[model samples]
Target: MPDENTDSLRPPPPTGWRRRIARAPLLLFRAGLGPLLGRRLLLLHHTGRVSGQDRRVVLEVVAYEPDSPAWTVASGFGAGADWYRNLGADPKTVLQFGNRHHAVTARFLSAEDGAAIMEEYGARRPRTARRLCAFMGLPSDGSASALRRAGRAIPFVRLESDPPRRLESDPPRPFV
Candidate 1:
């Protein structure tokens, strides 16, 4: 029911510099290589509300869960980011990784989960921790607790991938 009966709340796509960046991300990345250079690119396919069709977008792959219920992906620019907004509006989406397309449902991460991951991130990538924190717009409040608090504010999407699908020209299933 996530996408149902939300007629009055509909609006146009995001615009301005963000729109420009979305349109030509390669150029933006070229212009700012340090923070913007990304290796993994994922194509997300979602249902368009007004257009009543499928919408495909290229997103930079961020985080993946180890043995958790969902895999998390952070919006580099924070909550107001377009892809985050779209997934929030509609949970159903498909992530294209190379030639494989994975059907998925996305949800915002719980406060506890976000905090734990933030700690892990700081520990694992200490050299870039401060800059990364600032990039998420977290103020330097001095307390380590402040970092955890900021983690809760930074939006994170957890994607739950669907079961495997079979192709027409595939071999039989492997034995258990």
Candidate 2:
């Protein structure tokens, strides 16, 4: 188990070649090859808080709900991560999963909710959850309580798709 006093063992964001490798997914996303990554990952398009310039990053989908059309992701690098902070500044953004894009609004999940989600994820994907916990510098005992504890520490964001708008040129459908 990780020391309770130490919130995270995660290192600072990557630099140099590590940064390049970390950003490789963005290239694939830009090349319209995001489908190759399937639904497990998504390309987030957000605006820089300071620069007002657009920024993009590929993040893993921690949990997905088809009915809500929502995708939850965690900031492995914690709250100080650029992307996480950027979303706080402006929750409205675009999310690209596979080849489809949707206008989404970020909803920050409470620590309790995050903990539950983490426990469920661990149950569903034990190995991946363990690896993720290790990567985040959290406990990887493959136990529900441990996973929940880790989850409570990590920040989670749920991206919900905005309802699609009808075009002015499109005819309205008649009620069945």
Tell me, by TM-score, which candidate is best.
Answer: 2
Task: Give candidate 1 regions above 4 Å deviation.
Answer: 1-41, 66-70, 127-129, 140-144, 165-176
Q: Pairs clashing in candidate 1?
A: none
Candidate 2 whole-model C-alpha lDDT, 0 to 1: 0.88
Q: Number of backbone collisions per candidate, in order?
A: 0, 0
Worst lDDT run of 10 residues, candidate 2, spans 1-10
Alpha-carbon deviation at 139 in model 2, angstroms:
1.9
lDDT of each: 0.60, 0.88
| Candidate 1 C-alpha RMSD relative to the actual structure | 7.2
Worst 10 residues of 1 by lDDT: 1-10
lDDT of 1 by residue, 69-132 (tens): 2456666555545667677778888765544556889988876777666666656655455665
